[model samples]
Target: MSLRTTLRVKTPPGFRVDASALLPVRLAAMSVAEIERIVLPAGNDRCIVGDVFEVSRGEATPALEAPHAGATLVIENAAPWLDRVGARMTDGHLVVHGSTGDYSGFQMAGGVLRIEGDAGHFTACEMRGGRLTVTGHCGDFAAGALVGDMEGMTGGTLTIHGNVGARLADRMRRGLVLVGGNAGEFAASRLVAGTIGIAGQLGAHYAYGMRRGTLLLTQRPAQLPPTFTGGGRGFDVFWALLVRSLAGEIAPFSQWHAASLPTRYAGDLAVDGRGEILVVS
Candidate 1:
């Protein structure tokens, strides 16, 4: 018998499916049949969950026990239009075996959203709390606000193991975002507060209009944005504490705790923003 609840993609979504309502917390008590009967919004029409997915019941294990009790929803295929996979989720585990469409973890509050493959745009948008990990590349506007929303991710840890598209972490309020590879243009634009660590190169116009936040880059940019001006000191203690906290997030950032101070630029004078951009010099 299966050990967890598995949903195999039978037909790719042609329109957006608001699957946020179908979460692990709500499916733990339902039988396989019941879970299959759950309804999900397909654009303007409604479609039964089973109509698009082949459901399989998993054998109960510690994974479904009290502390972790909740049907582990396992997705086997990639569907780009299947938005909001774990939006507003409170608990349980959401494991996507393959790539998924936009809004994969939109406004996700709690629990783990793991995608083995790539993810679409708005990944983890307005996330309040929890852990979201995308093994592959993610489209634009990741960890940022929705179309009209002012704030982006408010809390949680978003780790992207691959490259990210434009506007990464735009207007992010709070959270720890670590990108393993390169980030596109306008990365961390209009940032409010939080820490972002990037392992690879960054695109142009980095940290423009950043109000406040920390952007830790492994490689220095070709040229600093004109809106910022260099200089700030006496942050050794603060940098020490900050690096120690970030040690677990990435490897290179660990050495920063003891490394020489980076060349700090404070501005976004365009907006009179107090944010600082640190370049490893």
Candidate 2:
């Protein structure tokens, strides 16, 4: 039996609240109304509680019920530009009720973050662990490798239930990205190691400069890039496990686009590239 707490924003200019930085912070212990009483620094000034939003409380068992379960915090009509909704979160769960700004879960270490609405750019950039599940669309570089650094998302899972913008998973070294909807161009460009599964139509320049990784698409195009060679149709158990594990994490993935067996292709032949591309044959 998990407790529930709803903390509403009660301020006007919402300049001093970043609930994310206080993550692993428990709200269930506090009364529903008390949760809203919490205060923060508002840009070199102080403000009254409950001026910007409201709070509600309920219970959460295994799944977040939006009411109960200290597991979730409903961001009821929070102001835009509220970044880092779950930055560096190590444990617990977070659910966003509406659209969130950029870097929603930057560098998250562990735990689960479900965004019920759209998210701005760099949603899960450089995340090391945990799962970031988005019910709606996502901005550019949804799970891209960190800027300047070579590795991005070393562990964890990213599932976008809706369309995703450009540069998806750019230069990522590890982890997995499953796009249930269409993905913009340059998907998996310069990827080193990991898996990117795109269910809908892929944009142009797929796997650009990819050195080593796996890109799985539903379409069975006649030709691949000249740099790749067909590895023949085969059954991969790893893919089966991948789908099974992700299906529960990303519910939309329950819909299968192709058979369990798929054709595998290796390489962009541009770098030390041993990456493989699996397409539904």
Candidate 3:
């Protein structure tokens, strides 16, 4: 049998809660009382986890780790103050059944985190590895650099099914970010490397200052910035391969594998100009 833990939010906090303490690694062996005694940040003071969450459990099972079977954490009626819900998790499964606050999966190295409702800012900041899915809209800086941080997501796959706010994937060095809806201003700005696929319209400065990376857009931008220029053909083979890869990731793009070539642009000449932006016809 698998062990499952559920944290039911009883009251919404007026201020934020640093929920990094709830990571699967930390909860692996804790008993009900111990889990409840965990400290959380509530505005200027500290509050016990018990004060806000009612804990419940399923059949007993082993701890959660990579490749290990069946351990789960579920947050029911999640509040916006619950930040960093699964930060730094190296393994296990987590589900937030409602809207979540900022830094939801900050720097997570591995595991799966699924948010069923809207996500606040910095949804997946500086993530190194893992799969994070947001079923609803996300605020600014999703999968982008944290304030003052040098880079954004370093590795992993972040899929958002709804609209994304500004600076999506900024300075991301590696990984894939897929947005099923529109992306805000400076999308993919200053990217060092990685792949970003957006199925809707882009805000201004779509690829501004981007140093490297591939951005796949299903729609055209209001205007292409001066830093970019056309990328001539000779990319047919690359296109074929990319479509095959993307087809498995986003169901809506399953037909992309047979679709015609998209218009390509290269540069952010202000930098290495090695990055590419492709817009589908």
RMSD of each: 2.8, 3.7, 2.6
Tens digits of per-residue lDDT for model 3, 1-281 = 55678899997666788898886646757888999999997568778888889998775344332356356788899978788888888787888899989898999889889899999999899999999999999989888887788899999999999999999998899999999999999899999999999998888877889989999888787788898998767889888887887776764555575458889999989899999988876
Ranking by lDDT: 3, 1, 2
Q: Pick the candidate with the highest TM-score.
A: 3
TM-score of 3: 0.92
**Candidate 1 to native Cα RMSD, angstroms:** 2.8
Off by over 4 Å in 1: 1-3, 13-16, 59-71, 254-257
lDDT per residue (tens digit) for residues 1-281 in model 2: 55545545555554534445434346545665565566644456644346555666666546664332236555655545566678887666777777777777888888778888888888888888888888889999878865787776677889898999999999888898889888888889888888888888777787888898788887765457778887754445676776666566454455543346667888888776688888754
- Cα miss at 49, model 2 (Å)? 6.8
For all candidates in order, the CA lDDT equals 0.83, 0.73, 0.85
Candidate whose lDDT is highest: 3
Model 2 regions more than 4 Å off: 10-19, 22-50, 55-58, 65-71, 221-223, 233-235, 247-259
- Candidate 3: lDDT over CA atoms? 0.85
Instruction: Give the clashing pairs for model 1.
Output: 2-58, 2-59, 3-58, 3-59, 4-58, 80-101
Give the Å error, residue 126, model 1: 0.8
lDDT score for residue 272 of model 3: 98
